[model samples]
Target: MPIQKVTRDEILQKALGVFKRQGYHRTTMDDLARACGLLKGSFYYYFDSKETLMKEVLWWVNRTSEQRIFSVAYQHELPPDERLGLFLDRLYAAVLVSEGGCIMGNTVLETAMITDEFKEPMLVFFTNWTNAVAHIYETAYPTAQALKLAQQLAAEIEGSLLLVKLGSPESLLRDCRERAINRLNVPMHDCTSNP
Candidate 1:
């Protein structure tokens, strides 16, 4: 018999969905394996343990955000407001906001206190996100104020995502997007505009 070859990327893609939907503690190796279309034993060929796989997943999430989400913040060709809008749009699409809540947010809430391994990656992910928003806010306000507003935007978005999960309304994300743009005094425009 031949051992099946699975790329790390393939495993992470499927594992991310499982973790996002089922969370860390509740998700088993079998669950991740099944998500990857591998048997439990075969899963070990790719990862030593769930924690190792999860750490890789977090790294994968961070890399994806850097490439797709955070990169929008650095688009100097776009106006700050447009950059911010595009950033939110990319974030919504990347997280598949309609299907499952933010994976990083869910993972942090589920594992922040219990797992030391997740701490640094979570912090790095959030700090980068905050800085990206803050850079946009800085265009209109002082540095300290910009950072404060950025932090507020981050919190509001996370809370809005929670609201979405609570059956409040799908429009909650749009409302948050509007509030963020309004709070920053950015001209009202379609956040869904392509970057």
Candidate 2:
């Protein structure tokens, strides 16, 4: 019989789905090991503790998001509206519309208030997301206004995602995407000069 060797990325990818489905506290190391096709002790070989694995998972999600989703905002050739659409589409595919629905947000809600362990990596996920959206919005709005709008949009989208899981109409997200893109679709107004 041949022994199968699993890479860390392979484990993280599989474990991501489990964490997304079960969340941090509810998911046990055994569950993660099973998901990775390893025994519980074997799982320890990859991660010293469950929290350590989860912290790595959080950062892994952040890095994956930066590569697959947030990078859309920096495509200089694309117009703001198009870039925003691509960004939202990728986000929707990655987490928003997936069965688990926003792993980072879910973990933050489940873990942030009680334990600070997951805070740093999760902050990177959100901060990078906000910065990406702000970059897109900056195409049309002032820097401060862009950041404000990006923050507002992020809050709205995250809240709406929960509402979506609770049987709210999917249009809630459509409305969010449309409003964000619409805001960027317009020309930026200058308050300091010109009539």
Best candidate, TM-score-wise? 2
Cα lDDT tens digits for candidate 1, 1-195:
344567999899889889888888999998988878788999998899999999999889999999999989889899887898899989988776445679889988998888688888888899999998888877767677678778888888888888878888868888777777765664235222321
What are the per-residue Cα lDDT tens digits for candidate 2 across 77-125? 9988999999998988888544778988899899989999999998888
Q: TM-score for model 2?
A: 0.92
lDDT of every predicted structure (CA atoms):
0.83, 0.86
Candidate 1 lowest-lDDT run of ten = 186-195
Clashing pairs in 1: none
Q: Which residue pairs come into collision in candidate 2?
A: none
